[model samples]
Target: MQLTTFFFVCITNASSTQFWPGFKILLVTVVVLLAVKNYKFLVLVSHALFLMIP
Candidate 1:
């Protein structure tokens, strides 16, 4: 919920060309924080998601 709100705020505040780089940085920061807090769960979820793809 908070992440979604933050993403929308970032989107609205930035131009198109700036959005991707900012989003990538935001995404990496989030993933690192999540990984630190739940390393095993994060890995398992990612693997499950990978397998679900065709």
Candidate 2:
């Protein structure tokens, strides 16, 4: 529920500030933080994906 609400808020805010530099930075930071938090899991999944590409 909370995640859905957060996405809704981001969508509404993005519609209005789609070109805002700060928004872009904030989005990048969020993505970076998520990547950092899931670094190991991401690496494992990506490794599996690569192995399947044969």
Highest-TM-score candidate: 1
* lDDT for model 1: 0.51
TM-score of candidate 1 to 2 decimals: 0.39
Instruction: Write one digit per residue (lDDT tens) for candidate 1, span 1-54.
Output: 465445334434543334567665675466556656766646643653344344
lDDT (Cα, tens digit) per residue for candidate 2, span 20-52: 778755754564455466665345434433443
Give the Cα error of residue 37 in candidate 2, in Å.
1.2
Per-residue error (Å), model 1, residue 28: 0.5
lDDT of 1 at 50: 49
Worst 10 residues of 2 by lDDT: 45-54
RMSD score of candidate 1 (Å): 7.7
Q: Which stretches of candidate 2 lie over 4 Å from their true place?
A: 1-18, 40-54
What's the lDDT for all of these models? 0.51, 0.50
RMSD (Å) of each candidate, 1 decimal: 7.7, 9.4
